[model samples]
Target: MGLADALAEWTDVDGAQYELGRATGLFADRTFLQVKWVLWSSNPLGQALYDMLHALVRAGVLEYRDEPDHQFRWRTAAPIDGLDG
Candidate 1:
Protein backbone atom coordinates (compact mmCIF):
# COMPACT_ATOMS: atom_id res chain seq x y z
CA MET A 1 0.00 0.00 0.00
CA GLY A 2 1.03 3.64 -0.43
CA LEU A 3 2.06 5.95 2.40
CA ALA A 4 -1.38 7.42 3.04
CA ASP A 5 -3.04 4.03 2.92
CA ALA A 6 -0.47 2.67 5.30
CA LEU A 7 -0.82 5.62 7.66
CA ALA A 8 -4.60 5.33 7.62
CA GLU A 9 -4.41 1.68 8.53
CA TRP A 10 -1.99 2.38 11.32
CA THR A 11 -4.17 5.09 12.82
CA ASP A 12 -7.30 3.01 12.38
CA VAL A 13 -5.83 0.06 14.22
CA ASP A 14 -4.70 2.31 17.05
CA GLY A 15 -8.09 4.02 17.46
CA ALA A 16 -6.37 7.33 18.18
CA GLN A 17 -7.23 8.76 14.76
CA TYR A 18 -10.90 9.27 15.62
CA GLU A 19 -10.16 12.60 17.22
CA LEU A 20 -8.36 13.72 14.07
CA GLY A 21 -11.34 12.75 11.93
CA ARG A 22 -13.62 14.65 14.28
CA ALA A 23 -11.40 17.71 14.22
CA THR A 24 -11.55 17.92 10.42
CA GLY A 25 -15.32 18.36 10.47
CA LEU A 26 -15.29 21.22 12.96
CA PHE A 27 -16.70 24.29 11.18
CA ALA A 28 -16.67 26.43 14.30
CA ASP A 29 -13.65 28.16 15.73
CA ARG A 30 -11.27 25.77 17.49
CA THR A 31 -9.18 26.56 20.53
CA PHE A 32 -5.48 25.87 20.97
CA LEU A 33 -6.25 23.29 23.59
CA GLN A 34 -8.65 21.58 21.24
CA VAL A 35 -6.05 21.42 18.47
CA LYS A 36 -3.49 20.17 20.97
CA TRP A 37 -5.89 17.55 22.15
CA VAL A 38 -6.41 16.27 18.61
CA LEU A 39 -2.69 16.11 17.95
CA TRP A 40 -1.98 14.54 21.32
CA SER A 41 -4.60 11.91 20.68
CA SER A 42 -2.36 10.44 17.98
CA ASN A 43 0.85 10.63 20.01
CA PRO A 44 1.10 12.56 23.23
CA LEU A 45 4.90 12.75 23.10
CA GLY A 46 5.15 13.72 19.46
CA GLN A 47 6.89 17.08 19.57
CA ALA A 48 6.95 17.07 15.76
CA LEU A 49 3.16 17.32 15.65
CA TYR A 50 3.24 20.42 17.84
CA ASP A 51 6.05 21.87 15.82
CA MET A 52 4.21 21.26 12.56
CA LEU A 53 1.20 23.18 13.86
CA HIS A 54 3.40 26.07 14.88
CA ALA A 55 5.04 26.01 11.47
CA LEU A 56 1.67 26.19 9.78
CA VAL A 57 0.75 29.23 11.83
CA ARG A 58 4.04 30.84 10.93
CA ALA A 59 3.51 30.11 7.24
CA GLY A 60 0.02 31.66 7.29
CA VAL A 61 -1.46 28.30 6.36
CA LEU A 62 -3.12 28.57 9.75
CA GLU A 63 -3.97 31.82 11.46
CA TYR A 64 -4.42 32.64 15.12
CA ARG A 65 -7.85 33.87 16.09
CA ASP A 66 -8.78 35.99 19.08
CA GLU A 67 -11.81 34.09 20.17
CA PRO A 68 -13.04 35.56 23.49
CA ASP A 69 -12.79 32.08 24.92
CA HIS A 70 -9.14 31.91 23.97
CA GLN A 71 -6.28 34.38 24.51
CA PHE A 72 -5.40 34.31 20.77
CA ARG A 73 -2.92 31.54 19.99
CA TRP A 74 -3.37 29.50 16.86
CA ARG A 75 -7.10 29.32 17.48
CA THR A 76 -8.42 28.96 13.93
CA ALA A 77 -7.87 28.80 10.16
CA ALA A 78 -9.20 26.73 7.33
CA PRO A 79 -6.38 24.97 5.50
CA ILE A 80 -5.64 26.92 2.35
CA ASP A 81 -5.57 25.24 -1.05
CA GLY A 82 -2.51 24.91 -3.34
CA LEU A 83 0.24 25.77 -0.91
CA ASP A 84 2.08 22.64 -2.04
CA GLY A 85 2.73 24.15 -5.42
Candidate 2:
Protein backbone atom coordinates (compact mmCIF):
# COMPACT_ATOMS: atom_id res chain seq x y z
CA MET A 1 0.00 0.00 0.00
CA GLY A 2 0.96 3.66 -0.32
CA LEU A 3 2.54 5.53 2.57
CA ALA A 4 -0.58 7.52 3.52
CA ASP A 5 -2.73 4.38 3.55
CA ALA A 6 -0.10 2.70 5.64
CA LEU A 7 -0.24 5.46 8.22
CA ALA A 8 -4.03 5.53 8.30
CA GLU A 9 -4.07 1.88 9.27
CA TRP A 10 -1.48 2.54 11.93
CA THR A 11 -3.61 5.12 13.67
CA ASP A 12 -5.90 4.53 16.62
CA VAL A 13 -9.41 5.73 17.59
CA ASP A 14 -8.13 9.28 18.15
CA GLY A 15 -5.78 8.87 15.29
CA ALA A 16 -5.67 11.93 13.06
CA GLN A 17 -6.80 9.78 10.19
CA TYR A 18 -9.79 8.38 12.05
CA GLU A 19 -10.77 11.84 13.14
CA LEU A 20 -10.31 13.22 9.64
CA GLY A 21 -12.43 10.51 8.07
CA ARG A 22 -15.09 11.15 10.67
CA ALA A 23 -15.23 14.85 9.73
CA THR A 24 -15.65 14.25 6.03
CA GLY A 25 -18.79 16.39 5.90
CA LEU A 26 -16.70 19.46 6.69
CA PHE A 27 -17.53 22.73 8.45
CA ALA A 28 -14.24 24.54 7.94
CA ASP A 29 -12.24 22.04 10.00
CA ARG A 30 -8.62 21.60 10.87
CA THR A 31 -6.52 19.45 13.18
CA PHE A 32 -3.62 20.89 15.08
CA LEU A 33 -1.58 19.81 18.08
CA GLN A 34 1.28 21.43 19.85
CA VAL A 35 4.49 19.84 18.72
CA LYS A 36 5.99 20.50 22.15
CA TRP A 37 3.22 18.56 23.79
CA VAL A 38 3.91 15.64 21.52
CA LEU A 39 7.58 15.87 22.25
CA TRP A 40 6.97 15.76 25.99
CA SER A 41 4.22 13.19 25.90
CA SER A 42 5.26 9.69 26.91
CA ASN A 43 3.40 8.03 24.07
CA PRO A 44 5.73 7.33 21.20
CA LEU A 45 2.90 5.95 19.14
CA GLY A 46 0.93 9.13 19.54
CA GLN A 47 3.81 11.22 18.31
CA ALA A 48 4.40 8.92 15.41
CA LEU A 49 0.75 9.02 14.46
CA TYR A 50 0.71 12.81 14.57
CA ASP A 51 3.83 13.05 12.51
CA MET A 52 2.45 10.66 9.97
CA LEU A 53 -0.80 12.58 9.75
CA HIS A 54 1.00 15.85 9.19
CA ALA A 55 3.17 14.32 6.55
CA LEU A 56 0.20 12.91 4.71
CA VAL A 57 -1.49 16.27 4.71
CA ARG A 58 1.65 18.03 3.55
CA ALA A 59 1.97 15.51 0.76
CA GLY A 60 -1.51 16.54 -0.46
CA VAL A 61 -2.91 13.05 -0.06
CA LEU A 62 -5.11 14.29 2.80
CA GLU A 63 -6.41 17.52 4.20
CA TYR A 64 -7.61 19.20 7.37
CA ARG A 65 -11.03 17.78 8.17
CA ASP A 66 -13.03 20.39 10.02
CA GLU A 67 -16.09 20.41 12.27
CA PRO A 68 -17.85 22.35 15.03
CA ASP A 69 -16.69 20.25 17.96
CA HIS A 70 -13.27 19.17 16.77
CA GLN A 71 -10.90 19.30 13.84
CA PHE A 72 -9.67 16.26 11.97
CA ARG A 73 -7.18 15.24 9.30
CA TRP A 74 -8.35 13.05 6.43
CA ARG A 75 -7.92 12.14 2.85
CA THR A 76 -10.70 13.25 0.55
CA ALA A 77 -12.55 10.68 -1.44
CA ALA A 78 -11.83 11.26 -5.10
CA PRO A 79 -14.45 13.18 -7.08
CA ILE A 80 -15.17 10.21 -9.33
CA ASP A 81 -17.83 8.66 -7.08
CA GLY A 82 -15.86 5.42 -6.84
CA LEU A 83 -15.49 5.08 -10.58
CA ASP A 84 -12.01 4.07 -11.55
CA GLY A 85 -10.00 7.10 -12.68
Candidate 3:
Protein backbone atom coordinates (compact mmCIF):
# COMPACT_ATOMS: atom_id res chain seq x y z
CA MET A 1 0.00 0.00 0.00
CA GLY A 2 0.98 3.57 -0.56
CA LEU A 3 2.26 5.77 2.24
CA ALA A 4 -0.77 8.06 2.06
CA ASP A 5 -3.04 5.08 2.39
CA ALA A 6 -0.98 3.75 5.26
CA LEU A 7 -1.20 7.07 7.08
CA ALA A 8 -4.91 7.21 6.56
CA GLU A 9 -5.34 3.80 8.18
CA TRP A 10 -3.16 4.56 11.19
CA THR A 11 -5.20 5.13 14.33
CA ASP A 12 -2.50 5.43 16.97
CA VAL A 13 -0.57 8.22 18.60
CA ASP A 14 1.63 10.13 16.14
CA GLY A 15 4.91 9.61 17.95
CA ALA A 16 5.20 5.85 17.61
CA GLN A 17 6.34 5.61 14.01
CA TYR A 18 9.74 7.12 14.71
CA GLU A 19 10.61 4.72 17.51
CA LEU A 20 9.73 1.78 15.31
CA GLY A 21 11.68 3.04 12.32
CA ARG A 22 14.69 3.96 14.41
CA ALA A 23 14.49 0.60 16.14
CA THR A 24 14.80 -1.16 12.78
CA GLY A 25 18.24 0.43 12.13
CA LEU A 26 16.85 1.06 8.69
CA PHE A 27 18.29 4.52 8.53
CA ALA A 28 21.53 4.41 10.47
CA ASP A 29 19.61 6.69 12.86
CA ARG A 30 20.25 9.53 10.43
CA THR A 31 17.40 11.35 8.68
CA PHE A 32 18.80 12.74 5.45
CA LEU A 33 20.65 9.59 4.45
CA GLN A 34 17.46 7.60 4.83
CA VAL A 35 15.58 9.84 2.46
CA LYS A 36 18.45 10.09 0.03
CA TRP A 37 18.76 6.34 -0.16
CA VAL A 38 15.07 5.58 -0.58
CA LEU A 39 14.61 8.30 -3.16
CA TRP A 40 17.71 7.40 -5.07
CA SER A 41 17.49 3.62 -5.06
CA SER A 42 18.57 1.66 -8.19
CA ASN A 43 18.09 -1.95 -7.23
CA PRO A 44 15.50 -4.14 -8.92
CA LEU A 45 12.10 -3.29 -7.37
CA GLY A 46 14.19 -1.29 -4.89
CA GLN A 47 14.85 -4.10 -2.45
CA ALA A 48 16.31 -1.71 0.11
CA LEU A 49 13.00 0.03 0.50
CA TYR A 50 11.02 -3.15 0.04
CA ASP A 51 12.82 -5.18 2.66
CA MET A 52 12.83 -2.43 5.27
CA LEU A 53 9.27 -1.44 4.54
CA HIS A 54 8.11 -5.03 4.77
CA ALA A 55 9.39 -5.23 8.31
CA LEU A 56 7.57 -2.06 9.27
CA VAL A 57 4.37 -3.30 7.71
CA ARG A 58 4.63 -6.63 9.48
CA ALA A 59 5.44 -4.86 12.74
CA GLY A 60 2.27 -2.90 12.07
CA VAL A 61 3.74 0.16 13.74
CA LEU A 62 4.69 2.71 11.11
CA GLU A 63 3.19 4.92 8.44
CA TYR A 64 5.54 5.03 5.48
CA ARG A 65 6.30 8.25 3.68
CA ASP A 66 8.37 9.74 0.92
CA GLU A 67 9.62 12.16 3.55
CA PRO A 68 9.78 10.13 6.72
CA ASP A 69 11.99 12.66 8.51
CA HIS A 70 8.92 14.77 9.27
CA GLN A 71 7.04 11.95 10.94
CA PHE A 72 6.95 11.35 14.68
CA ARG A 73 8.66 8.50 16.55
CA TRP A 74 7.10 6.04 18.95
CA ARG A 75 8.98 3.72 21.31
CA THR A 76 7.73 0.18 21.60
CA ALA A 77 6.40 -0.77 25.00
CA ALA A 78 9.34 -3.16 25.39
CA PRO A 79 12.56 -3.73 23.48
CA ILE A 80 14.13 -7.18 23.05
CA ASP A 81 17.13 -6.60 20.87
CA GLY A 82 18.55 -10.12 20.66
CA LEU A 83 15.22 -11.70 19.83
CA ASP A 84 14.31 -9.28 17.07
CA GLY A 85 13.65 -10.98 13.71
Candidate 4:
Protein backbone atom coordinates (compact mmCIF):
# COMPACT_ATOMS: atom_id res chain seq x y z
CA MET A 1 0.00 0.00 0.00
CA GLY A 2 0.98 3.58 -0.52
CA LEU A 3 2.19 5.74 2.33
CA ALA A 4 -1.04 7.62 2.52
CA ASP A 5 -3.02 4.41 2.78
CA ALA A 6 -0.80 2.99 5.52
CA LEU A 7 -0.82 6.27 7.41
CA ALA A 8 -4.57 6.45 7.17
CA GLU A 9 -4.84 3.06 8.82
CA TRP A 10 -2.77 4.27 11.74
CA THR A 11 -4.30 7.72 12.03
CA ASP A 12 -7.74 6.19 12.03
CA VAL A 13 -7.04 4.95 15.52
CA ASP A 14 -5.70 8.22 16.99
CA GLY A 15 -3.58 11.28 16.37
CA ALA A 16 -0.59 9.94 18.25
CA GLN A 17 2.92 10.66 17.07
CA TYR A 18 4.82 8.03 15.06
CA GLU A 19 8.48 7.79 14.15
CA LEU A 20 9.41 7.90 10.47
CA GLY A 21 12.00 5.13 10.55
CA ARG A 22 9.80 2.75 12.47
CA ALA A 23 6.86 3.46 10.25
CA THR A 24 8.91 3.01 7.08
CA GLY A 25 10.33 -0.23 8.43
CA LEU A 26 6.82 -1.58 8.88
CA PHE A 27 6.19 -1.26 5.15
CA ALA A 28 9.65 -2.09 3.80
CA ASP A 29 11.78 -5.19 4.08
CA ARG A 30 15.08 -5.39 5.99
CA THR A 31 17.01 -6.00 2.75
CA PHE A 32 15.59 -2.80 1.32
CA LEU A 33 16.71 -0.86 4.40
CA GLN A 34 20.15 -2.43 4.39
CA VAL A 35 20.69 -1.78 0.70
CA LYS A 36 19.53 1.76 1.00
CA TRP A 37 21.72 2.34 4.01
CA VAL A 38 24.77 1.12 2.11
CA LEU A 39 23.85 2.78 -1.19
CA TRP A 40 22.72 6.13 0.32
CA SER A 41 19.53 6.02 -1.74
CA SER A 42 16.20 4.70 -0.62
CA ASN A 43 13.69 2.57 -2.48
CA PRO A 44 11.16 4.33 -4.68
CA LEU A 45 8.36 3.58 -2.28
CA GLY A 46 10.30 5.21 0.56
CA GLN A 47 10.71 8.34 -1.50
CA ALA A 48 7.02 8.29 -2.33
CA LEU A 49 6.15 7.91 1.34
CA TYR A 50 8.24 10.92 2.31
CA ASP A 51 6.77 12.89 -0.55
CA MET A 52 3.27 12.09 0.57
CA LEU A 53 4.11 13.06 4.14
CA HIS A 54 5.63 16.34 3.00
CA ALA A 55 2.48 17.08 1.09
CA LEU A 56 0.42 16.35 4.14
CA VAL A 57 2.55 18.72 6.18
CA ARG A 58 2.19 21.43 3.56
CA ALA A 59 -1.56 20.92 3.55
CA GLY A 60 -1.73 21.13 7.37
CA VAL A 61 -3.21 17.66 7.53
CA LEU A 62 -0.26 16.38 9.53
CA GLU A 63 2.35 17.83 11.84
CA TYR A 64 5.98 16.83 11.61
CA ARG A 65 8.36 17.22 14.52
CA ASP A 66 11.95 16.30 15.29
CA GLU A 67 12.86 14.80 18.61
CA PRO A 68 16.01 15.67 20.50
CA ASP A 69 17.61 12.48 19.21
CA HIS A 70 16.87 13.54 15.61
CA GLN A 71 14.07 11.11 14.91
CA PHE A 72 11.02 12.49 13.10
CA ARG A 73 7.49 12.11 14.32
CA TRP A 74 4.18 12.74 12.59
CA ARG A 75 0.66 13.13 13.88
CA THR A 76 -2.58 14.50 12.57
CA ALA A 77 -2.89 18.23 13.12
CA ALA A 78 -6.38 17.91 14.41
CA PRO A 79 -8.73 15.21 15.48
CA ILE A 80 -9.85 13.24 12.48
CA ASP A 81 -13.52 13.54 11.65
CA GLY A 82 -15.74 10.66 12.86
CA LEU A 83 -12.76 8.84 14.34
CA ASP A 84 -12.04 11.32 17.09
CA GLY A 85 -15.46 11.22 18.62
Candidate 5:
Protein backbone atom coordinates (compact mmCIF):
# COMPACT_ATOMS: atom_id res chain seq x y z
CA MET A 1 0.00 0.00 0.00
CA GLY A 2 0.98 3.62 -0.43
CA LEU A 3 2.37 5.40 2.59
CA ALA A 4 -0.55 7.74 3.10
CA ASP A 5 -3.10 4.98 2.54
CA ALA A 6 -1.38 2.63 4.94
CA LEU A 7 -0.96 5.41 7.47
CA ALA A 8 -4.58 6.43 7.24
CA GLU A 9 -5.99 2.92 7.26
CA TRP A 10 -3.80 1.24 9.85
CA THR A 11 -2.27 3.80 12.17
CA ASP A 12 -3.72 5.26 15.33
CA VAL A 13 -2.42 8.76 14.50
CA ASP A 14 -3.37 9.33 10.90
CA GLY A 15 -2.88 13.08 10.98
CA ALA A 16 0.67 12.84 12.21
CA GLN A 17 1.49 10.19 9.60
CA TYR A 18 0.06 12.22 6.76
CA GLU A 19 1.86 15.34 7.95
CA LEU A 20 5.12 13.52 8.28
CA GLY A 21 4.74 11.95 4.85
CA ARG A 22 4.01 15.36 3.38
CA ALA A 23 6.89 17.04 5.19
CA THR A 24 9.32 14.41 3.90
CA GLY A 25 7.72 13.92 0.49
CA LEU A 26 7.44 10.27 1.31
CA PHE A 27 3.85 10.17 0.17
CA ALA A 28 4.61 11.75 -3.19
CA ASP A 29 7.76 9.75 -3.74
CA ARG A 30 8.34 6.23 -2.53
CA THR A 31 11.78 5.66 -4.02
CA PHE A 32 14.56 4.13 -2.00
CA LEU A 33 16.81 7.07 -2.74
CA GLN A 34 14.25 9.49 -1.38
CA VAL A 35 13.90 7.49 1.78
CA LYS A 36 17.67 7.20 2.15
CA TRP A 37 18.17 10.90 1.66
CA VAL A 38 15.51 11.75 4.19
CA LEU A 39 16.77 9.34 6.81
CA TRP A 40 20.40 10.30 6.31
CA SER A 41 19.86 14.03 6.23
CA SER A 42 20.57 16.26 9.21
CA ASN A 43 16.90 17.19 9.55
CA PRO A 44 15.30 16.24 12.86
CA LEU A 45 12.09 15.44 11.01
CA GLY A 46 13.87 12.48 9.46
CA GLN A 47 14.53 10.94 12.85
CA ALA A 48 11.00 11.48 13.99
CA LEU A 49 9.69 9.85 10.85
CA TYR A 50 12.04 6.93 11.28
CA ASP A 51 11.05 6.52 14.91
CA MET A 52 7.37 6.45 14.14
CA LEU A 53 7.81 3.88 11.36
CA HIS A 54 9.98 1.78 13.63
CA ALA A 55 7.36 1.82 16.31
CA LEU A 56 4.71 0.74 13.83
CA VAL A 57 6.87 -2.15 12.72
CA ARG A 58 7.47 -3.17 16.33
CA ALA A 59 3.73 -3.13 16.91
CA GLY A 60 3.21 -5.41 13.86
CA VAL A 61 1.31 -2.86 11.83
CA LEU A 62 4.00 -2.73 9.14
CA GLU A 63 6.71 -4.88 7.68
CA TYR A 64 9.87 -4.21 5.70
CA ARG A 65 10.47 -5.65 2.24
CA ASP A 66 14.06 -5.64 1.05
CA GLU A 67 14.40 -5.86 -2.68
CA PRO A 68 17.17 -7.68 -4.50
CA ASP A 69 18.51 -4.30 -5.62
CA HIS A 70 18.58 -3.15 -1.97
CA GLN A 71 15.48 -1.03 -2.06
CA PHE A 72 13.78 -0.37 1.26
CA ARG A 73 10.04 -0.74 1.33
CA TRP A 74 7.29 -0.91 3.93
CA ARG A 75 3.82 -2.41 3.66
CA THR A 76 0.93 -3.02 5.96
CA ALA A 77 1.23 -6.25 7.82
CA ALA A 78 -1.49 -8.08 9.70
CA PRO A 79 -3.75 -5.80 11.68
CA ILE A 80 -2.90 -5.30 15.30
CA ASP A 81 -4.93 -6.82 18.13
CA GLY A 82 -7.18 -3.89 19.00
CA LEU A 83 -7.46 -1.95 15.75
CA ASP A 84 -10.39 -2.69 13.47
CA GLY A 85 -8.45 -2.00 10.31
Candidate 6:
Protein backbone atom coordinates (compact mmCIF):
# COMPACT_ATOMS: atom_id res chain seq x y z
CA MET A 1 0.00 0.00 0.00
CA GLY A 2 0.95 3.63 -0.38
CA LEU A 3 2.07 5.77 2.53
CA ALA A 4 -1.37 7.29 2.93
CA ASP A 5 -3.05 3.91 2.99
CA ALA A 6 -0.51 2.51 5.43
CA LEU A 7 -0.92 5.50 7.72
CA ALA A 8 -4.69 5.14 7.64
CA GLU A 9 -4.40 1.54 8.69
CA TRP A 10 -2.04 2.49 11.52
CA THR A 11 -4.38 5.16 12.85
CA ASP A 12 -7.17 2.61 13.09
CA VAL A 13 -5.38 0.99 16.00
CA ASP A 14 -5.50 2.14 19.60
CA GLY A 15 -1.86 3.12 19.72
CA ALA A 16 -1.19 6.82 19.41
CA GLN A 17 2.25 6.72 17.81
CA TYR A 18 4.03 4.66 15.17
CA GLU A 19 7.72 4.02 14.85
CA LEU A 20 9.38 4.84 11.56
CA GLY A 21 10.55 1.27 11.24
CA ARG A 22 7.00 0.00 11.61
CA ALA A 23 5.76 2.32 8.93
CA THR A 24 8.55 1.34 6.58
CA GLY A 25 7.96 -2.29 7.28
CA LEU A 26 4.46 -2.03 5.86
CA PHE A 27 6.05 -1.77 2.44
CA ALA A 28 8.81 -4.27 3.10
CA ASP A 29 8.38 -5.82 -0.31
CA ARG A 30 9.61 -2.61 -1.90
CA THR A 31 12.98 -0.96 -1.66
CA PHE A 32 13.25 2.21 0.41
CA LEU A 33 14.60 4.10 -2.58
CA GLN A 34 11.55 3.07 -4.61
CA VAL A 35 9.24 4.49 -1.97
CA LYS A 36 11.31 7.62 -1.77
CA TRP A 37 11.19 8.08 -5.52
CA VAL A 38 7.43 7.74 -5.62
CA LEU A 39 6.92 10.29 -2.87
CA TRP A 40 9.35 12.65 -4.47
CA SER A 41 8.06 12.21 -8.02
CA SER A 42 6.27 14.79 -10.15
CA ASN A 43 2.90 13.16 -9.78
CA PRO A 44 0.33 15.66 -8.53
CA LEU A 45 -1.19 13.25 -6.04
CA GLY A 46 2.22 12.48 -4.57
CA GLN A 47 3.05 16.14 -4.33
CA ALA A 48 -0.23 16.89 -2.65
CA LEU A 49 0.26 14.19 -0.09
CA TYR A 50 3.81 15.33 0.59
CA ASP A 51 2.59 18.86 1.10
CA MET A 52 -0.16 17.71 3.40
CA LEU A 53 2.29 15.81 5.58
CA HIS A 54 4.46 18.87 6.00
CA ALA A 55 1.40 20.96 6.73
CA LEU A 56 0.45 18.56 9.47
CA VAL A 57 3.84 19.04 11.04
CA ARG A 58 3.45 22.80 10.92
CA ALA A 59 -0.04 22.55 12.35
CA GLY A 60 1.15 20.43 15.30
CA VAL A 61 -1.13 17.62 14.15
CA LEU A 62 1.92 15.51 13.53
CA GLU A 63 5.45 15.31 14.80
CA TYR A 64 8.55 14.05 13.04
CA ARG A 65 11.25 13.52 15.58
CA ASP A 66 14.80 12.56 14.86
CA GLU A 67 16.48 9.68 16.60
CA PRO A 68 20.07 9.39 17.68
CA ASP A 69 20.68 7.15 14.70
CA HIS A 70 19.50 9.91 12.39
CA GLN A 71 16.25 8.17 11.60
CA PHE A 72 12.85 9.76 11.95
CA ARG A 73 9.99 8.73 14.17
CA TRP A 74 6.53 9.99 13.30
CA ARG A 75 3.45 10.27 15.40
CA THR A 76 0.14 12.09 15.45
CA ALA A 77 -0.09 14.98 17.85
CA ALA A 78 -3.80 15.25 17.25
CA PRO A 79 -6.30 13.47 15.07
CA ILE A 80 -5.04 13.70 11.50
CA ASP A 81 -6.67 16.76 10.00
CA GLY A 82 -7.72 15.81 6.44
CA LEU A 83 -7.27 12.12 5.97
CA ASP A 84 -10.57 10.64 4.76
CA GLY A 85 -9.86 7.03 5.52
**Which ranges of candidate 3 are over 4 A from the true structure?**
1-38, 44-46, 64-85
lDDT of 4 by residue, 1-85 (tens): 3334445533421112222333556424544345443224456645655565666567556555544322222344454564321
- RMSD to the hidden true structure, all candidates: 12.3, 11.5, 9.8, 7.9, 7.8, 9.1
Off by over 4 Å in 6: 1-40, 65-85
Model 6: how far residue 74 lies from native, Å: 5.3
Better of 2 and 5 by TM-score: 5
Q: Write the per-residue lDDT of candidate 3 for residues 1-85, one digit (tens) a residue.
A: 2233334433232223322344455444466444454434565424544455546545653444445443422223323454322
* lDDT of every predicted structure (CA atoms): 0.37, 0.44, 0.40, 0.42, 0.51, 0.42
Instruction: Sort by lDDT, best first.
Output: 5, 2, 4, 6, 3, 1
Instruction: Summing lDDT over every window of 10 consecutive residues in candidate 4, give the lowest-scoring window.
Output: 12-21
Residue 12, model 1, lDDT: 23
Off by over 4 Å in 5: 1-40, 68-78
Put down candidate 6 lDDT per residue, 1-81, tens digits, no spaces.
334334542331112112222344533455545456445457664555445555655765455443432222234343556
* lDDT tens readout by residue for model 1, 1-85: 2222323322321122222333444312654455555544655534444454446457754333334321112223335564321
Clashing pairs in 3: 15-73, 15-74, 16-74, 18-73, 19-74
Better-scoring candidate (TM-score), 4 or 6: 4
Number of the top candidate by TM-score? 5
With a 3 Å backbone cut-off (N, CA, C), the pairs that clash in candidate 2 are 29-66
Candidate 3 Cα lDDT to native:
0.40
Q: Over the full model, what C-alpha lDDT does candidate 4 score relative to the true structure?
A: 0.42
Most lDDT-accurate candidate: 5
**Candidate 4 clashing pairs, residues 3+ apart or interchain:** none
lDDT at 62, model 3: 47
Q: How many collisions per candidate? A: 0, 1, 5, 0, 0, 0
